[model samples]
Target chain A: MKKYFLPSLKLTLVTIILCSICYPLLIALIAKLAPGRGDGEKVMVNGKVVGYANVGQRFSDDKYFWGRPSAVDYNSAGSGGSNKGPSNADYLKTVADRIDSFLVHNPQVKKEEIPAELVTASGSGLDPHISPKSARVQIKRIAAIRKLNEDQLVTLVQQYTEKPLLGLLGPEKINVLKLNIALDNLK
Target chain B: MNTEMIGIIATFLITLILAFPLGKYIAKVFKGERTVTDFLLPFERLIYRFCGIDPNKEMNWKQHIIALLSINMIWFVYALFVLLFQGNLPLNPDGNPNMTPDLAFNTDISFLVNCNLQHYSGETGATYLSQMIVITFLQFVTAATGIAAVVVLFRAFAGKTTEKLGNFFVYFTQTLTRILIPLAIVIATLLAFNGTPNSFAGKDSLVTVQGDSVQVSRGPAAAMIAIKHLGTNGGGWYGANSCHPLENPNYFTNMLEMFAQVVLPIALVFAMGFFIQRRKLAYVIFGVMTLGMLTFMIPNIISETAGNPAIANMHIADAAAMEGKEVRLGVTASAYWQVVTTIISTGSINSMHDSAMPMSGAMMLLGMMTNCFYGGVGVGILNYFVFLIIAVFISGLMVGRTPEFMGRKIEAREMKIASLIALLHPFIILAGTALSSYILVHFPDAGWAVKPSAWLNNPGSHGFSEMLYEYTSSAANNGSGFEGLSDNNIFWNVSTGFVLILGRYLPIIGPVAIAGLQASKKYIPEAGGTLKTDTATFGIMTYAVIMIVAALAFFPALTLGPLAEFFNLK
Candidate 1:
């Protein structure tokens, strides 16, 4: 044990240098060539940074599209989900409340028409994307408030909606921040 | 098939296809055969000389264990201090404060053991320097430690009564240079390309087009995330783990991370087969493991996809469970990740386990409880080998003959070690739970950092499951959590901290000791009457043994936690 001590210590130090210092530096260097230069990809408008492409931002107004319910209220400083168990009365109540609020906002839509992602707090609590169905469901409220053509808003959503890889994986979804940004661009 | 299922199938199939060649490469690496990675030899030699370790110097099993544990001890202490003083340290991009002593203890031990059970959110809990040095650094070494230790087990099978189980430093260094580092570069590059942050920049403040300002936390996350999965060390750069968009990015990277975490564990099984010159036996073991994974995995997929019954009863349109799940991942991928991460003990999650349906939670618990179905890196095979030993002994008893594994007699000493190691897992988990339960019920207001009454995230049976999940995860050295549990309090931090150490080191010691003992015994020649341990029959026997052992130890606790919730929901 005594014999191994010096070697083990020396080896651990070298390993830390290699793994933590050298390796991360190398990856960070290579990341320089990547999109956003390894800093988060920012969605820019009029040369002004408007949230990260990946990190979700909360939008509570009726004039714009909103993302999924946020457990952390879309606080990007830290992230998390509601972590509510399916059988927990409190969590179910939270869901019920989300449903009630969604109904009040989009009274033209039936309660059953509410997409689950719209009401459920996403795992990251900062889910940037909502299913295309979720985006469409909000057309009536946004159109009524912004006085925009409903069809025009619908096409704008389709434009921002990201298709699944090869249309064979994942769900078709729109980044709420991007969609809302584009909505602001409409005359 | 639906596109969601397509994603799941592609991810898994790609992993299986890739595991074959990777396994062969790993086998060659440890066996000292010439390979593509031989270019790394000169660099490895430099490390050995600098560390004053003779790469050719072979150590007995006892020395190997000592060397492994000693370094791990150094790392544990070093990391604890770093976390406690991270606020004063450089790389304070976000200017994160120091961790409480108890939380530091839990975090250090958790990462040191490859458990990575984070009590604090990564964004605020650790500075960038600590993230790289402690979390990312420990992630690599701890995984390499497991791979290094299991190489001794390989020699035990292939050797003819020898104590030269190869040099621990050589295997350890070689694993990093040849496998983990190389793969990390590729994976990290791809992740960076797909929107994971890579800059040293601190949190970037952005004004949403809608006039709301937000702090977008950024750091050197791509590299940490790569090895975090590759090492099966699932500590997250963000509080939300892989569920964080920057951590996972998209479906492609999600599949990439999932595939990355399982690859080595699967490869090592084949490496063992290649090392021991028994491909058929490896298949038998692989078969039982896959069967076990699918058993729990399918139920989780069904439950998660069927959605929460409680939510369905709310008359909502969707029946699929999406709470604490991302829309991009949908249900199938999230469900697959829930089972795969726990079963492999990688513990990376794309969704929250806390919000899973009662049945899904039970299955996740079962995955960790049976922790050997394609477990963590090299540790998985080591664990499966212990079950193999038990199966061999039981069958030998049934046949009224002396038991033998790889022509080595299974004596009382070896059996004692194996049985105790097997028992230790459940012992620590159950004992820890009982203690926590006692504290919560008897001393709700114990003068701890956080009172026991407030420890749990949910009420009633679900809360009980939270306590049970923490212990089970610690006992299995699985770091994934029911994150809803407001842990980081002294009670949880201290209790689970102890469980993490005992759970990790004891299991490694047990397997290495058993392998060493088995190697030293005389190699008896094969005979007509010797039990054919590599056949399908033995696989069934081993499967039965695993089921009985896991069910017997954990069923009542499951009943009290997930099962009660399950039936009540019905």
Candidate 2:
């Protein structure tokens, strides 16, 4: 037991230095060369930082396209989901409320047309993007409120939609923050 | 057919190709045979001399376990102290406050046992100092502890009528140096290159076009994430885990993280075969594990991609189970990652498990509950060893002979230990779940400051699943959560802490003790009547035992949770 102590201590010290200190420091240095310089990429509008291109933002106004509901209230510092299972009454009520509110705002769209992503709180409270279908669902509401031509807003949504990687990996998603910025930029 | 499918296939093929060489190298290092990394011999010797450890000394199983447990206990105390006082410590750029005592206890035990069941958000809950010292440091050492224990068992298997297994200290250090550290460095460098943050900065504030200010947290995340996956310790640097874009930047990094979590566990299977010179037996074990993994993975992927029927009823277009999943990973990768993480006990999530289709949720739960489908680093193999003993005992009994495994008798004492370890898994999980359920159901208004309603974000069948999943994950030593349970309180922390300790140590102790006892017995030659454990028939029997045990103990609980949820969705 005595013999085991020194070796264990020495090894732990060496490992702490190697794994916890030097290794992270080296990786931090390398991260400097990547996009966003190890900080997330900032979406810029009119020479000001709008938000991270990858992180979702809160947009409650009728004039702007809304992102997914955030469990953390779009607080990137504490990202997470509501973690509510679908069968839970509270979760179902929350979804129903979201659906009711959506129908009231966009009376043209039926209750069934409201995408799940629009009603459900995302796993990462800061989901930067929404499915293209979710983005399209909000087009009528935004165009009605902003007094923009429906075709123009539809084109704008299409312009901002990013395709799945390698044309086969994830779903087509529109970055909510980016799309909202584009919405503001629109004439 | 599609690029996503091609990418998944490519990932599996690459992992298989790499595991064989890695397995061979691991065997050589543990055997002290000459190969690469010999240049570090001086450094190894210096470490031994400085620490006053005699590398030549061989320990019996009892002494090996004593050494392993003592070191772990020291680490646990150290981690608990560091975590409790982290707010006052230096290098805390974020100034994250000290954890409550209950949370500190849970986090420390979780990491020490290689469970990595995080109750607190990483950005706000842990300081940089705590993340580095308590979390990342334990990621390396705890993984090494499991590897070292398994290597000792391998020595026991290889030796003929030997009392000595091997030096635990030597195996522990060598595993860290030769296997874990090098792999972690490579993966860490790659992750950083792919845009994962590795900084000491606090949260960055950004203003949106809508004039809203947001705080984006940054830290030394890449290095921790690399080992978190490679070491099969799935605690994430951020609360979002791999679901966070910076944590898993692209599809490439996502694939890499999945491969990193799986490769070592698979390699360890091959390493066992190489060590015991029982390649056929290793192949049989590997085949069973792969078969189990595929059965779970295929169904999960299909169910997730099929989209939720409930959501489809709402006329949601592009309904490919996109909730709680990143657009970059989509359904296939997310489902694949769920199975990989659960089966291997990596627990890092590319998608939120709570939002998964009900059947997919069941598959993840089953993976952890069974825990032998290529489990965490060294521990997965250890858990499988228990099942092997049960299979041997049952098979021998059926043939009207005393159970003989590798020329050693499976006596009453060995059976008692193995049975205890096997039964303990379901007992802890079920009892804990039952107790939590009773508290939530019978005492909804008990006024414990946290109401039963507050414990679950979603009520009914899914709520029941959240509680069951928590205990199952805890007892399996697989740290993934259903994500909705408010489990940071005293009840959760204390309960899961006990379950984590028992779940981790008992299985470990049972397997090594059995192997040690077997090693010390007289060598008996193989005869015509001896059970051929290496045969395909025995492999099928082992698989049957694993499923039967899991089904008998967990089927009812599963029915209440994921199974009930599945039919409800239908």
lDDT of 1 by residue, B125-231 (tens): 89999999999999999999999999999988897988889999888999999999999999999999999998899988767766777788889999999999999
Sorted into a CAPRI-style docking class, model 1 comes out as high
Lowest lDDT 10-residue stretch of candidate 2 chain A: A84-93
Per-residue lDDT over B1-570 for candidate 2, one digit per residue giving the tens place of the 0 to 100 score:
666676677778889999988998899899889978988888877777776778899999999988888788778878999999999999887778999999999999999999999999998999988999889999999899999999988999897899998899899888877898889888988887777788778898876666677798888888899999988999999999998877886778988998899999999999999988899989999999998899789999899888877656556443557667776666788888999999988888888898888889999999998998989998899899999999999999999888888888899999998899999999999999999999887888777656765898676788888898899899988899998788888889999999999989988988999999999999898899899899889999999999999999989998998888889874
The DockQ of each candidate is 0.85, 0.49
Q: Output the lDDT of residue B372, model 1.
A: 97
Best by TM-score: 1
Candidate 1: clashing pairs of residues: A38-B198, B307-B321
RMSD of 2: 2.5
> What is each candidate's fraction of native interface contacts (fnat)?
0.90, 0.56
lDDT string, candidate 1, A1-187, tens digits: 7888898899989988999999999999999999999998888888888788898889888888888989998879989998888877887788889899989888889988887878889999889889888889999999999988999988998899899988889777788887887888899
The residue-level lDDT of candidate 1 at B103 comes to 91
The CA lDDT of each predicted structure is 0.91, 0.85
The alpha-carbon lDDT assigned to residue B71 of candidate 1 equals 85
